[model samples]
Target: MTSGPQHPTPDTHACSAHPADPSMAPAPDAERCAHGQAFEILSTCHEHIGERLGALEEVGRALRDAPELEQQHLATLGEVLAFLDTAIPIHSADEEQSLFPRLRALPTFAGAVGDTPMDCMEAEHIEHGDEKARLKAAIVTRDAGAVGRHAIALANAYRSHIAKEEEVLYPMARQLLTDPAAIADMTEEMRARRREAGLLKC
Candidate 1:
């Protein structure tokens, strides 16, 4: 029962190795029992996201206080961007490609969560990309005002977004993903997704 870090590093490994491509066929029950592990992976990802959001807010404050973007501020912003640019897609695939689809397929599951919540989550995922682009552009251009504006918005949006998943979606997953084969396949797909993204080694 290894666990992920409470606060991940700048270069957190996004992928996890699995027995095989769970997408191809359901693995044996003995090998497919990682539902709790899957939840832990997502929990670790959120912890990293929350920490980075705080850092982004601090970057916003620096931009607001200074007349011009300092070199240090730029460097910090670049690191934040790099982390999110890599991490967000990997996280999204964990949800959209693996988690959400699994939850959606369970007939009993929808009554508890409904379609709207999942739909909203997907929409926010897209908005995250848009906000990240805006922030990147603002940082590249050294437009402190735009950077600050988008940073605050992105942080706020994610805060709300993550809250919903933590409160509703993940709990639902824990209850429903008890089947050994399903859990194995879902967890394997999660690893495969990050591997495809070149996240590498976990």
Candidate 2:
């Protein structure tokens, strides 16, 4: 495991004044992963995810109270939605594509029984996706109750999922994945993903 900043600096200006339209609101700070530190990057991503989940929960509470999307709530919703759409997928890819497969190939994990930790994490990822879809649909239909319910559900699920990864999965990976070449490859792949998404300079 590598040591670095655990959380990105939030762009306070983005939400300084609520926009008239939620879609017009600026996005949250873009989380950046340091080169050649794949596990650190993943951990940083978890921090960002936690922040977004907090924002989502706040949105849920606001909606529950008013049952109408206020400007501030919409601004927060936009940030949360954008994170779900973009950052979450990339983070998932970092785990599923880069880290999980490497761990699975290791002898310690190769002979594991049915439904490994990786399986559970992937399954939870799918569940989170489903919940996000429901939340988005509710937002589109202006269903305040449904939006609040789904947002809170998604936030809770993601928080638990993050905990499992941080506590069990990440430490396991750090212990097992000690190959320098493998770490380099994972770092390159992650950087490539960001470059392709136009989030990183080549």
Candidate 3:
């Protein structure tokens, strides 16, 4: 096994103030991946997801505080929805196909990580899809109460989900995927999946 970079501290991901423009939020600091570069990519994607969640929470707050909806609020809702529609399914594929399979193949990881956690994660992805549909319907109907409820639910769900990946999943990926060749294979497969999904340049 190749000795690679150490796992980062959890505090490295402190949440910043919600940005006025959700699309313009600064990305997570890119890390050098001595082993699996896919972990680095996944971490950065999590940061983007976190920013969107923050924006979702802000929208929920606005809907609660005001009696009438405004154009700006609707625009922000649309912007966030557009991003979630595009980015999330691809991110899920990155984990379900590329990351989890490799991790589960390792004997040490197989027993420790087991099927339960991964099964739960996949189930949560399905839950997210259901929630996204409800959120879109609420936005279309211009129902502030429903929108606020769904936004808060989505944000809370992802915040918890991402926390588990950062704290447990990514750290274990860094530790177990120590072969340079294995890491390279994982990286290539992840990139290929993204390109096939039209999420990245081929």
Candidate 4:
């Protein structure tokens, strides 16, 4: 029998061309049969989020070091704003459009009605988007109040964003992605979008 690990596969595909996760523990047979793809995707998402959080931390440090805005600090602020503007939206959209819909399809997320992860995530995107705009303007206009407010907005949002995604969204998405068809669709959708956005190769 071809074991999962030893299963025949293509040479050019990613390590996940079959199914695997670096962060999650090995799934038991039943759970593996159900949520394997979700587990892998969740692991990758967490890594993505963690990396972004680290960059955001630098923004916080800059703010702390220079309580009074300085022109030199605009460079750091520019990096933070640009990252938030680009990266967060794509990640959030992947979860909302590709991942969360699959979750909401499952009976496990029936109670998730009205407050699906996608809906919550979309709201936060809009909220953070406003903060990003303010942060950019703070740099351009040299407005201390705007800088403080934008930094505070991102710091506050990161607190809740990481918590909710880790505690709520990851598990839920994992549960829903059990369906092979669902995972396959999500993989294709994400790959296409990423390629279009120049975030990935075809």
Candidate 5:
């Protein structure tokens, strides 16, 4: 990771506004898996998202005590906002458009679980979008108190959402979505999406 300016700039990379913090950088393996393996790419996204959620919580706590947005806080908040605006939508598409549909198509998927996990996951995605809108509004208004409140709320909700995917959905995906052709198609689709979004180098 490279250090960014004190103020946020519109950069292409998702975390381009942050300082050189190793913890805030995406996993190196994630870059390699970006265009190759669908499950690996999605799992790596979850890892990156988990890291950002932690950062969000930390910034929220700092904002609560600080009189105003400090330079570092501003940079961190910029990174978080950039991530929410960019990476999150792509990740959701990877799940909702690619993974979830395949999982739903599985013969074992319909009744194996009493309720549709995909429905729950999709609902939560919508809720997260709503929460993000609130957080962004607070940031725009320079309302430190509201920013802190909404940031923590978004982080907590995301953590729970990630937990459910990791604990329940992903495992099921790995087991049931086993056809090589299907996996290849999913990987290509994910790669195409990133390439089209200019997030992929190759």
Candidate 6:
């Protein structure tokens, strides 16, 4: 290890203002595998999702506080909507095809996986889709009150959903899946899916 101010002692403890999922990381050598790199992509998306949620919350607060929002505030809303439109299907597709299948294959997590965080998250995603549609409608109508209420609800919903994914789902997926070969296959699947969805570069 290079000795510098950058390297903290092993025993050093620091407070983190943000919630992070350590499970999303792979072992040092495992990073050579495409699945490990895919996790990195997913982690980036997680951060992106968090940012959009914050923007939505801020816009909702503005809408509720005042009837007339500045063009900048509306621009923020537009950005949030664009992010959601791009992220929701892709993120969910990855989970549905890759993570959930591997999770279901694990006997240890059978009932717990079905009933605990996955169940909660799936329900929230459905509700989130509905809320997003409503928000778009509200935006079209220029209904500030509708937009405000939907934004508040969506913010709360996303916060809960992301928390469960971070705290429970990602950890369980990491613990259950250990076959390097299988993860490699999953990574290829993610890549292919991305290409099919026009989410990947040629």
Q: What are the TM-scores, per candidate, against the unseen true structure?
A: 0.74, 0.80, 0.77, 0.66, 0.80, 0.74
Report, for every candidate in turn, its global Cα lDDT versus the true structure: 0.68, 0.74, 0.70, 0.56, 0.74, 0.65
> How much is 179 displaced in model 6, in angstroms?
0.7
Write the number of the candidate with greater TM-score, choosing between 1 and 4.
1
- Please give the distance, in angstroms, between residue 42's alpha carbon in candidate 3 and its true position after superposition: 0.4
Top candidate on lDDT is 5
Candidate 2 structure quality by residue, lDDT tens digits, 109-161: 55664446787788789999999999989888888888888889988778777
Clashes of 5: 0
Cα deviation in Å at residue 93, candidate 5? 0.8
Ranking by lDDT: 5, 2, 3, 1, 6, 4
- Any idea what lDDT model 1 has? 0.68
Off by over 4 Å in 1: 1-36, 109-114, 196-202
lDDT, candidate 1, 60-86, per-residue tens? 876775677788888878787888878
Tens-digit lDDT track for model 6 on 79-191? Answer: 88887887678878777777776766655544565454545556777888998999888888888878888898887777666666665566556656667887777777776
Q: Model 2: runs farther than 4 Å from truth?
A: 1-32, 200-202
Tell me which of candidates 4 and 5 scores higher on lDDT. Answer: 5
Clashing pairs in 2: none
Each prediction's Cα RMSD? 12.9, 11.1, 6.9, 11.5, 13.7, 9.9
Clashing pairs in 1: none
